[model samples]
Target: MGEHRDDLPLVLLIHGFPEYWWAWRNQIQTIADAGYEVAAIDQRGIAGSDKTPNSSDALTLAQDISAIARSLGASRIVVVGHGRGGQLAWAAPALAPGMVEGVLTFSAPHARAIQRPGTHLTLRTWRHVLTTFVPPLARRGLTDPVSLEHLLAEWSAPGNDGASSQAQIYAAAMRLPEAAGISLDQLRWSYTAVQRPTGRRYFELTKNAIEVPVWSVRGQLDPLLPERAWRQDHTFTTGNFRQITVANSGHFIPEEVPEESSQIILEFLHHVAHQA
Candidate 1:
């Protein structure tokens, strides 16, 4: 909330599903102006990024995140994500523990927690069930502006109309050729991917691999990923993680509350800097 007294570390933002770099357009400059080097990229398979539709699982996405950090030539980095990207933000620390200085997530639970056994607290209105199970139908019908609008509206706490700058960007991105496949891969693999031997081990091993401090930001208005998930924050990782719930916002907290989101991030970054 206050002006950053010292420059923070490099912070790379990864956007949620059905969106691109433009989704973070509102928060980018604001966070950058607070004295940290910042960059938000289109995750692979959407918008301007490459499309490895079949291979776009969370672990691979986390790899892309680490590679992006190295490409940017930053030594100490902080990873932030929203929605599906939030899952990757959780994995980034495990993938690049030494390189990542901090981890921050919005609108998503930690990957391992959601994938762990005996955990069945899904949000009230997760459209992912339909999207992942009925990919063909979802792809055929969801790209239409009306359907996209409905999807975003249901997910938002305040009910977005798919017209805000952020929602508009998502509406356009979800219509891309690779978008449907990417969306399906995201949630489908979220749990299924962990079923494989390698994935099962990755999920278990990384629970404690994330030693860097983390900040899990949630939208109080989120319909699909609501306050219930916050109860499991302690299970996200064995790292130092805290939760901050934003009001008057839904799944698209960054879009709806850019100023507040930026301040929360700056405060967290500053706190991490002082601790180091």
Candidate 2:
């Protein structure tokens, strides 16, 4: 593959579930302005990218990353992922160590095993449950206009901000019930495969000690990922990691606080590159 340009280092920004490349609208422009070659693609079944018939298990998603990077002519890259994409960020490096140069994740645990210590983690497990159980019901409900709006509102961040339009476009792309949320078929297949023993093995590989430098960012007020809960989790490597807590943001860090989010990423990249 041919490089886009020699002056700019390639950075592959991967999006989380319920999102496509549009999720990183704020970060993409900022990174590009800073003179980096940035390419943010829709993950499978998300947007302009191909929605393959196979399961969207963690390994399949990670392999997609390798293909995306190589297709963009990136010999190695500074990879960034958020939320569910953060899970991919952790997994991709361990699964294909030689291809990734640096890693950054936001608002979610890296490939570490799910450690449910108390009611909170157990309650948070609803994400998996809902995705598994409600997709069919959701598909049916989405057939209604009112239900479709509700689904879009739920999948999207609920606030009028700079990123709100981007969120709307993303929500419109779901199109399962004609621009609602994920289809029952997508949900059923993904959940079935991800819950398997082999799926657990792939996640284990992602959590395996990533020798490359890593950064984790979270917001103090994020509802989905509470600061206290994340602080108590010990799955990631502490010695080689850095954590930044934004004062009053939420799980959707990129949208909640774009400037701060972008700044933290820029700083981490500079520090890691200098150390290298």
Candidate closest to the true structure, highest lDDT: 1
Tell me how far candidate 2 lies from the true structure as C-alpha RMSD in angstroms. 4.1
Best by TM-score: 1
lDDT by residue for model 1 (1-276), tens: 335334456889888866778767777877767767788998878775777744556667778888988898777788889988988888887788688888889888876556555534554544466556887777754566666666666677554543243444566677777776776676677758767765776576566646778889988777666576667667655667788888888888887777788788878888778778
Question: What's the true lDDT of residue 96 in model 1?
Answer: 81
Prediction 1 global C-alpha lDDT: 0.73
**TM-score result, candidate 1:** 0.88
Give TM-scores for every candidate, taking all chains together and pairing residue i with residue i. 0.88, 0.81
- Which portions of model 2 show Cα errors greater than 4 Å? 1-9, 113-117, 120-128, 140-167, 176-194, 228-235
Instruction: Give the C-alpha miss distance for residue 119 in model 2, angstroms.
Output: 3.2
Worst 10 residues of 2 by lDDT: 176-185
RMSD list, candidates in order: 3.1, 4.1
lDDT of 2 by residue, 1-276 (tens): 233346434788887655677878888777776667888877676655666654355677778887888887777777788877776777777766677777888876654433344444434445644745765565445445455444434433445243444544654566642223333444443345446765766755655577677888876655555555566434465436777777766566787678888898778667666656
